[model samples]
Target chain A: MVLEATNNVLRLDANFVDYTLVAIYFVFVIGIGLLARRQVSTSLDFFLSGRSLPAWVTGLAFISANLGAVEIMGMSANGAQIGMATMHYYWIGAIPAMLFLGVVMMPFYYGSKVRSVPEFMRRRFGTGAHLVNALSFALAQLLIAGVNLYLLATIVNVLLGWPLWVSLIAAAAVVVTYTALGGLSAAIYNEVLQFFVIVAALLPLTLVGLHRVGGIDGLVDKVNNGPVENMLSSWPGQNLTGFESPAASVIGIVLGLGFVLSFGYWTTNFVEVQRAMASNSMSAARRAPIIGSFPKMFIPFIIIIPGIIASVLAPEILALNEGKGDGNIQYNDALLILIRDLLPNGMLGVAIAGLMAAFMAGMAANISAFNTVFSYDLWQQYVKKDRPDGYYTRVGRIATIAATIIAIFTALLASGYSNLMDYLQTLFGFFNAPLFATFILGMFWKRMTATAGWAGLASGTIAAIGVAVLSQDALGPLSVGAIDLKGQGASFVAAGAAFFVDIVVSVIVTMFTQPRVESELKGLVYSLTPKEDRTDPNEKNLPWYQRPVLLAGISLVMVIILNIVFH
Target chain B: MADTDKQAAKEKRAIRAFDIRTIIGALLGIYGVILVLMGIFASDSDLKGGDGSSTNLFTGIVLLVVSAFFLTWVRLRPLLVPEGDDDAADAHIE
Candidate 1:
């Protein structure tokens, strides 16, 4: 903790009033939380904001869901470690995934009025499938929450010189408390405030970092001449044959992550899914992600550019220690280093505050969504049965506290990892890929049975765990090199295999399992269509235009473009 | 008989237009699936280099073109509502 590091660590002209400006900025966020408390009442109101938010709110909330310290820290670290290829995560990965989800997948959730994604799956598939998806989601979020808190701590430790644990505890406590008190409404409102502050504070820092580094051209020249820059330019493969080729490295980034990872994230993750569920209408839900996607276009420039610049600024420290040493790259430390050694005093505090906002936005979103799923899908749907509005609100608060505790424990455990970004991404793959496969299969394919969903989930989990364990042993012959197997990719492969297996098995089993009763089938399909249309005798003769088909088309076009471009 | 004949004519016209959006949407969705698949495999290749920057630029251009077409096409097509389709409950397109 370097809080007491020289006060004039990085001298730049600033007014004495900057401190006041920073304080006022925090107060504004707190004010949003307070004002939002009026919106939470019933369990639905608490969890989903009574399913009536405007597109902008949902849009801001969607971006805030991603505006975690892990993403910010990881993006910068990636830039420092991998060069410009890091931008592919957003350009080729996230944006298209988001648009696809908004247009193609959201209608089912909003149309059938599902409180949680797992519940929607259960309704369409079966309870066993629902449980697997639910548990996996909880596990994934636990890892995500942990990594997010760790990054927040690092930022605080780097800038404010505060103890990692102290910062972690403070961030966790504030986010948990506010989320518990106001539910999704408070989180969304607070997120809007954080979004503005982060952009205002960090955007300027990125510009200055580039300017000081003598712009992109200067940075590029510096990198070309530096020994450390060579490592950053090319990815090293453990196999050491053709595996280490720079072209292969780029392709891996474009395909492995840009498309597969992006689709899995936006389409299935609870936080992103919940944003659409919060919108007032299907149209609004669709609009939310489109609007949210716009911010992502600028994010790589704001976050990653600084890291690339940092590499040039501190090539000596950024050096990779191979063989005899820990091989520490300290890519994650670049942002804090920049703030402490680059930005002036008052602005340092403002930037730290912006980092704080990023952490809180992520924490608040997770807590709010976790509480919603637990209280609505798990609690009211099962435990309480019939409680008053006030009672549900109180219970929702308790659930929020419980979720916060789980997240804190997760964060504490996750803090031990040296590379926060790698851990976060890898850990997400462990569960996310499987969950996504099941959800996509369950949603689109009517023939997918519950048996298949459960089997896929169990098998995927086992496969991921197996690979993770074996990869650790010397005899296992694991050769990913810098990449960890127990991390996201192994899980993703296992999950994907299970999903494909389930589709085949479920189809086979369904033949023996008896088709869903005509009554059940009718309820499922007809509920998704307008009642009057269903009742019409000449429905086939009516216009064949379908909204899902239209949306799905746009999603298809975008995905194709991303693949082609990134490929 | 005249009224029935008139109604049938309108339905025929609506169905023709309806085919446009559904066909286009379906085509776009197929493309999206392909792209996702390609992203998975392509990520392990050379699509991410300074020299590879051309690949990204080209892909982006294709996407912009396709998206522009789909967006414009969808707007041009009207919702193909069935006659007496008043049950708002079925509006869900998922």
Candidate 2:
């Protein structure tokens, strides 16, 4: 990371009370781990919360698991760089896909009782697709986990002024002990706690920042009259998309981010799918992502608005980002600058705790998911089969420790990025976009053979990486400048390329190969599975408001309204 | 069969004793109390060129209200462990 030597790096500027609040928060996190330890006995409990969490709990955990580096630092960075156009990430990019996961995808995931998303792939397309998915998914989790761990320790380094390694080790120890002790239950419990704590921490920063910028009207007036054009509007997003033409910008965001990237991420990423899988019943499982969608659509207000406020209040932020000023505060520091300027000590402590909670929760989610796939999909399926249930649980704990150790090194790789989201999006485009393509194609089209499944996954991943490498400034210095797309334009184009390649390859491969018999495709494929099989019988008696379809419909409408209003 | 049921019941009893909502409620209550106290006692001289709005006090009250809701919900619908293998527990909404 480039040290902004002229300016302090996210200094809490704390006193006695601020440290006290953060310490108390840590104690509560450890306490929750101890409470959850009693619930774990079998590997199932350790990995999947024994599939016994309530919808409300799982729903909150679904969103909270996501509220890590991306939601805070990444979105705020987008908010600073692109202004109102950043809302695309939430309203169009996330909400619809999340609802799709709830109403369309969760039945296949939960009803079949697969332990992980890759396990479902195994059942559908045999071991070839399963192996490809498991290896890629495991690798993706570790790299992403490293990102979360690095950011968490970065906050600790700034707040306490500790050496980077010392902060890294301390942060890792807290997450690993809790995750190892109680496993998924512990992580889920802490995630719910972290959710509330993070909200408490951020809500005040937003309101206070808004107050400083005068109000909503004042913010609009200032932005409308500010230095840049197209910052106030979310549509076309010319500034964000790096397109001179409005048409190209709109198409890029909708097809690249909205259709391909969003669907790929929300539907197939096991880190998210695992949260819904932990729900006790089919109905609760389906409802998890939908319940999450309610808060998911509205989070940009709390997260991005603060960044907009920071950019206005601190003119040096933009000046430094554009290399016009001698000072060195990047756009990634937008939220930190707000915290420093707007908040007093009591709330400052809360804000610091919130940033830690966000990073920790994100790392814990990744570590927990990594351990599960490592133990079940990689270890048990491949290395040591027929092990006793208790033996696998032990392996999971060991895997948690091993993942933490590996993540310490991986964290170093992430330090190179000025804006963390750029790195994160490139990773997601490589891993998730192709995986989503293979998953959706196989799930809907029964003729998609096992050979096609693995082939599409491999080829699509290569294509995404290939496109990203060609784009300007996407892979940092590794980019070749063959492509003119800038910033997240490379990510969007890469995701689109991955999706297209996966589909075309799968179709061509399927024509030359044999598919499984219709009888074998029952719950895994769309057309072959009966409608009744998708829903739990108990869901019949659920209230209208609580029904999955009704909830998803409501969520879809609300997100559409938000998009139009913001547009 | 009887022995298995007895074991399941005992395990369920242990689980019920450590209700997750209770932990969340208690922690939120602690943070809320601390913040409320600080909001009352902390001098306002620190805020830059102050408007008198108490961000700490308001945030504390909201946390307390949310904490109360969680505690109340848990009291109304406590966890029930069904008489079956752990794989097939009855799904109940909290």
Candidate 3:
């Protein structure tokens, strides 16, 4: 029964036209890769687009690189489980941090001329902090890359009615081909392409889903009348945060998710930052995240709302949610169920292609980031110090292939969870939360020593892992259940704990150690950097709306309005 | 100086030939045409999801419009790879 229902949802009754559309999309994806390969003459070109892409290109790639497995599958799963509360992941969790990245952090990153995020750590701190960051970041990318690969494989399993292993290899091969051939240029260009394909596919699905459910007001009624209550509105979101009181839940989400997890992921993570760094000019780099935030604001309407629609609209999902349906149908299958039910041939093919694009975009991001760090940070800084530029580019290509293969194995690990978001957030809490803490303190406080940097990062990560383990069932069977926290709230609390511990350790360690010389800290430390160094020179020439500051201000206002309306 | 000028010319040509806007326009245009064809020749069963409304037709037309806009934007205000070497871009790093 479970197998049959899973099959029913997985295999859309797609005809020849649908297959042709998907085939065309695939051809375009590979063609873009081949085209990008022609331009890859140096290591910089392969890894960083030679820092020569325009603002709009990088901006779209910045968001599209993120729209992969996490946004479409994980967030949609969150929407299916929690309803309106999922809006917070965008309004509360992403927009402000994105603006902060554009306004405050991009200057430091682009200005430093660092090859990668961990490389920035090397400049600000030292080798100790750099090694720790590089290793952990590489691991995180592999783990997350596996999640995207596994989901892509899962879709293939259903679509072709093939086994999981075959599908996994097939999906991994596609991402590997483009990234290995063209490197970051391939990934970025294809990402820009995938972005449009994704919107084209998902937007239609959302509109059709809303139509099926009689629009937003109608969805609200169905939800209220259905098995769930208070889903149409976003407020405390008790179920989402796993906190008992409304106030506590709100506090947890704001502090943990909004401030720590969100900023940590958006600002510090190289996957998104690499896109900004690829910009030809500092002004363009500054504008990247700000531009991304506009579309980022409304993405939840299409991605998350469709999940909500599926939850109430699809009988299979409703049954699965109620614990009476097929065993294989979980909240993660929410978007798939909607696609299978609502879309007909030509659009169905496009949706399948979109899903494929999303998964590849996500996995490609992780792979590209992984290879860059592996070659530039881990290899160049430590292992192979004086290799030719061409050698490092070769190393990068080899690393891409290596990461993709390892991700195939990691994909197996990702299959253990039913809802992928919880696991993803847990990993973010461990890596990003502590990293953000160290970054914020070191950037603002000149007194933060190199000793504190590594020490704080190491201890904070341990603290987060410890917290997640202690929380009952949050990490699955290994959890001690010593803490009362459960659900996504545990990750939030873990991130908060990680942030606090890192800050405390950094400060305590800083008091004893000798601070870096002020002379050396210029441009690396905020107060020491010149006013002119941080601001773009050409920015004044642009119109009011084109400027980063004004664009960010407008974005902040729009997000606030969205939050209130949803509440 | 002559070599730099030659290099800059080659770079500008690369930018124009492989402009992202052109790729996006071409892909979207192709998909749009295919989708429009599907919409026109759609069977009765295809309209079931849209409650007899041709969703394919509507989406296809919308995509075509967006595709046209992208292509026109490329023609009117093409992406400019700033002339001269990117040494100035790096000079800002300090």
Candidate 4:
């Protein structure tokens, strides 16, 4: 039955027209990248686009840089399995954190004029904390880039029957060519272009799927009649409620993902923050994330809705091992299956191109972030001091190439991990959960000594890892009744546990240690910063409706309404 | 005279918005029309894939409109070369 079910899923073979469409996409993207090269004249331009991007460009790239291969593939798969519950990652998890970054944290990040997040850590905490962050972030970015490359290669292999190595090398070559030549400017520009391609490709797929599933009403009816319970609900509750797991309690979701993971990634991660930092003005920097939140609010309709439709229409294909026994579902195949079964020849080509765009954009974003951090925070600071400007630029390009090679090897290593998305999130828990705790204390509490910062980070990471290891079912010491909190639940619990550990350790250490001098703490801590330094001057000039705060408020309200309606 | 010309060229290059409009506009316009045509002459097999709907036509039209917007935006407010010191500290870091 399993074999037959797998065979039933449609396999698309691209015609000349489809190939032509993909070729054109490549031409335009590379052309844009090469054109952007003309803008790169300095190390700053190579790494930071000379800090001259307008709000619109940076804003779009800010979100697009994150809409990588994993997000589109993994979220859609989660949507199929979890129903409306998956929307929590966007609404409850992402929006508020983004607004927080724009409103509160941007003043510190952009105001401090730090080249990267680790640089901020160095200034606030000390070099010990900085090295810990820079090394971890650089390694994590490389691992993620490899994961994306592997995922894209797998898709191309499955669809076109091309050899995996061929696909991997081709993708690496294109990304390296554009990224090494154009730097961040090229990456950002391509990110914006990829955003459009993704929307153009996926939006049509959603519409077509909805039409096939008999629109929203039809979808609701089908899901209501399907095997999955509460497929349409977004709120937590009893058996049929959303977030069906006992471990996925409302508090767990709020604290684990919403506060810890979201803030860690959105506020501190250089991959995302670089976009906002490249904005031409302080006001634009503040506005970038807010502008991104608008499009972000509506993304689930395109990515998630198709997954829901698939659950009702094609459950056999989504089932693990083709719906055999108690195996895990092939959740990664969710988006690929939708494209193959839904889109016709010409449109099929366009959609595949969009998928390719997603893969490359994701890889480029990570590589760009990796190169910047390595060159600025690690290399320039430690390896070579007082280097010429052109020297660093050359170093940056070399780093891009070296990182891509490392990423290719990493992608090969990641093949052992069956579920890419779950592995990615678990990795985030190991690093980001503890990091967020340290940042909160450093930013808000002026008394947080550098010793406290380093201690907090170390203890927090150890606690998170310890919890993750113990929670595994093989260990079984921490499992409740039928609920294996060590599985998917481990990430959530570990994050919350790490947060507490960091706070306790940080506070206790601070009391016994001497704080940094007030002179060194200026503009770095919240309480010590002046009013003019904290507030955006453009706020008074812009009308209330056009203000960043107001726009964020509107977005928050919309999310609340969506939760209620879906509930 | 040569120095002045060189300086002007530098200023223009610095001020220009990354020059992506023509590329995006041309691609969208071209593909948008093709999809529009495909939608019009689509066979019954094509319709089956879309669940008996003309999504291609609708999507094509939307793309065309978006392409037009990009073209119009470039025409109305061309990107300018940014002026001022490129490396000035805009924020108070100390």
The candidate maximizing DockQ is 3
lDDT of 2: 0.82
Model 2 agreement with the true structure over A1-567: per-residue lDDT tens digits: 333322355666788888888898899888878877887756777899878888888999998998997578878877877788999988878888999899988998887778899998998898998987888888878887887888777767766687778888999999998999989989988888888888888887888777877888888887777665667789989878888889999999999989999999989888888999999888999999999999888888989888887777777666754557554566777888787777777777788888898899999999999999999999989999876577888999999999999988887766655456356546655878888888888889999999999899888988998898888988777789997887777788999999999999999999999998888889898998888777888788999877999999999988889888888
- Model 4, A153-227: lDDT tens digits are 766766776777888888898999999999998999888888887898899988888878888899999888876
Write one digit per residue (lDDT tens) for candidate 1, span A1-567.
112223323232333333444455455555555555654534565777656666766877798788887688777776765565566667667877777777656666665667778777667666777766666666666566766766666555545556767877877777776777668877876676567557645665676667677886887787777544343332322111123456654554444455555676778777877876777656667667776776765677778778777776754335642222233335666566565455543344456667787887887777776766666566666678666555767877987787777877776666554344354445456556556566666555555556666666666555544444454321133424334433333433344443455455555665666444444433234333454422324423534332333443554565466445533
User: Candidate 3, A205: how far from true, in Å?
Assistant: 1.1
Q: Report the poorest 10 consecutive residues by lDDT, candidate 2 chain A.
A: A1-10
Q: Return the candidate ranking by lDDT, descending.
A: 3, 2, 4, 1
Model 1 scores a TM of 0.72
Q: Each model's TM-score, in the order given?
A: 0.72, 0.94, 0.95, 0.92
How does model 3 fare in lDDT? 0.83
- Selected candidate, larger TM-score, 1 vs 3: 3
Worst 10 residues of 3 chain A by lDDT: A1-10
* Residue-wise C-alpha lDDT for candidate 1, range B1-94, written one tens digit per residue: 1345344434432342322233323333333333333434443333322222232233334433554565576678555344422122122112
Candidate 2 local lDDT, B1-94, one digit each (tens): 1346446534753554677788878878877887787777777886543642277778778889988998998899887764334443321110
Runs in model 1 deviating more than 4 A are A1-19, A228-255, A321-329, A416-428, A467-499, A518-567, B1-94
Q: Which CAPRI quality tier does the interface of model 3 achieve?
A: acceptable
